[model samples]
Target: TDTPVWVKGSGAASDYLALHDRPSITELIATKKAAEVAYKSSSLTAKNIDLAEVHDCFTIAELLATEDLGFADKGDGGNFASQERGLRNNGDVTINSSGGLKSKGHPLGATGTGQVVEIFKQLRGDVEKGRQVDDAEVGLTHNVGGSGATCAVHIFGRSPND
Candidate 1:
């Protein structure tokens, strides 16, 4: 454990169980609520994150997550995706460096753990060269369930003080 990745903050939240009951179709309120708590606890905003692993059960889910997680403007996730702004080595904050849930099939309960492992390796500079994120000092993982009714966010950093 020479290269340690610290868990700077963690947050979880839940909203209405039924999707139809939520206020917005394009946003996951649970994610926003969870992110707010995580950011406050970590004293780090979305702008401080260098990389993020988000739940992408569907193509649109990724887009929504980007917006809900504050990576993009509320309606700009499409542009973000089209511009490859979330792609590794392509943007300010790399999204899904592990190829995400789409590329790496959703393993039921193991998805979030897989994300943490990806960030760990990336922060430690131990991932495959092509897959590694350059100097990733901070990372985030977003997980959601129950059709966006529930969410969990965790932030990590290479330094304890970060």
Candidate 2:
């Protein structure tokens, strides 16, 4: 059975510059911190992740997430996404294979739980055939709470019950 480790982070109100106003446009600072804690707690690294469900509220959000989660270097998010490193279910870290919030549709309060559900299914090999990440032993879920002010990151894997 695979155990889980989690972490969370919140940026300060003073850090609330416009989304476009941040010094590091390519960075998601809260995500970075949250991911750091999760990995530290779990004693794993980005390369160990098999798949992930991230808040893709926008295309840009997904891009920044690639870097924030340590799957790619800063400023190389787009490249990471395009170069078969962050693709669906087979890349270094399969990203948003549940079609993301864009195609899967976001249901406000249920979004975070929804992400967990997808990860739960994925780890169980319960996702659709073409979408399943083979040997999805380590799954990560990233839920952002509005405008990056707060965020939660969790690492999961197979459970004894499953």
Candidate 3:
């Protein structure tokens, strides 16, 4: 059995907050909620993930994503992205081995699927050298649109045959 996209998204409560309540920009409640749903649906947690591809419309977006996606603790996203901890292609829980949306030319509507393609290659051991996560059995993709108004989180894993 092949693993298809196990996806989830944020909803109303956070939507209201994003508009008026304005709790905390760093919180990224919308993205965080979607991540929660995705993890639950996949029966996995951030620690269980082997790699991830996240939106990086700006540098700070990556930081928010890492924490919201559960790869790092609250307020630790910056350090998590730093060199000491390694989220590089070869590190534990490798992040953005595909060079992410920024390097991929940020093709707007295509960014989400592009993230999927990277995860597909990584899971199938088909990506080029120096950028494939070693033995990546599970991966995630995080995509958000227009100032955090919409978010999508997806979990992918190896097929039973693979």
Candidate 4:
């Protein structure tokens, strides 16, 4: 069974401060901690992972994702982005090659599952259009809503026999 945790960072200033001084920092730390927990709990390892479909809602989100996903350290995600390694197909961790909300149309009602559809296609080699990851066996998705009010993270894989 998968247990999803939703961390919010909105509402009155009191609500915001109660969680943390800065939502971004809280999100960053929480996301990183979540990744550490997930990575350690699962039998799957990062090197064995092939690709990811993260919520690069803003350009900054993309940078944060690299860190959150354990592909890059806290401050290194931006540097990874600068090298074109942050989210390219051949990058260290192929991320949001789907163009994310940046290019992919974000239909509010379907955005979360939409990211899954993209990852499913990518992992199964079912995508032939722009930004398809080559032979991706494992993939991940990160979804969030309204400045971290709601978030979901998922990991997917393609079995050899599938």
Candidate 5:
């Protein structure tokens, strides 16, 4: 607790259990609702985020997250991710610098905690070289479950005022 990362805001939401019951195939309503609350409570928009550790159990999930979280437009996530712009210090926000769930083996129950740890270290500049987001002051972690039936979004800052 010595190296503190402030929780600026947090939100959670849930939706239909089956993907087919959802209105869209490529988007998660739970994620969007959670993000809206988190962003509003933090008094920050997606542009204010320095980095994000989003649920990427699948490559498409990551892209969907980028859109749902407001990091990119509804359909531009693929483009945003492909341009090297999502890399550390390259664009509006660095994404998945920890290699995300796909690379981190999902970790099932511990996935959200793992994301928080990554953000904690990232804010403190304690991560391995080449993976740290330069000057990371505000970060976000998006966790999902039940095949996008539920989602939790949290924003963290270097300081409460950030």
Candidate 6:
């Protein structure tokens, strides 16, 4: 399940804060609520997650992502980053270790797949860099556009049949 909200305009820096008042906060709350519902209604378990690739359009986005994905709590993303809890090759839940839009690159048409590609490699342990999680069996991806105007989130893992 997914929830979408509409804002007034282009959501600039000041506009973003005014509109969402800490987008990460909103995302964290949503994430937790979603997880709760998912656990009670489905066979999925959060502990099964092994890694993630998020829309790190900027360093700040990476920070916010961990919380949004339930990897950390509100306001703890920065601390997690500082402590290197989301880096590839390290952290419990690797976030954007692919360099994301911040480092690797961002191709509009291929942006979504690029993010997924990283997740695919990480989950398959085929990554080539300092950001490879060991034996990642599950992965996630967060894609957003225009300062969070639009977002598409997805989860991936090794299927039992695979």
Leading candidate by TM-score = 1
Whichever of 4 and 6 has more lDDT, that candidate is: 4
User: Model 2, 19-116: lDDT tens per residue?
Assistant: 77666756767788888878777777888788889899999899888888888888888887777543443457888878888787777778878888
List runs of model 6 lying over 4 Å from the truth.
1-42, 86-91
Report the poorest 10 consecutive residues by lDDT, candidate 4: 6-15
Quantify all predictions' global Cα lDDT against the true fold: 0.91, 0.75, 0.77, 0.62, 0.91, 0.58
Q: Is candidate 2 or candidate 3 better by lDDT?
A: 3
Spell out the clash pairs found in candidate 3: none
lDDT of 4 at 119: 78
Q: State the TM-score for model 3.
A: 0.84
- The count of residue-pair clashes in candidate 4 stands at 0
Error of 6 at 84 (Å): 3.2
C-alpha TM-score for every candidate: 0.95, 0.81, 0.84, 0.72, 0.95, 0.67
After superposition, candidate 4 runs with Cα above 4 Å error: 1-27, 86-91, 160-162
Top-down TM-score ranking? 1, 5, 3, 2, 4, 6
Rate residue 47 of model 4 by lDDT. 62
Model 6 C-alpha lDDT per residue in residues 1-162, reported as the tens digit of each score: 121111111111112323366444345333344344433333444555566567777777777767765677777888877774655435366666676776756776677788777776666667776667776666666666656545555566655321
- Per-residue accuracy of model 4 over 17-119 as CA lDDT, tens digit each: 3335555553554455445544554445456556777777788888877776777777788887777554344646786777787686666767768887877
Ten contiguous residues with the weakest lDDT in model 5? 83-92
- Writing each residue's lDDT as its tens digit, candidate 5 over 43-133 gives 9999999899999999999999999999899999999788766455455788888889989789999999999999999999899887877
lDDT of 1 by residue, 1-162 (tens): 889999999999999988788888879999999999999999999999999999999999999999999999989998887774544545478989999998887998888999999988889999997788888999999999989999999999999998
In angstroms, give how far residue 100 of model 1 lies from its true place.
0.5
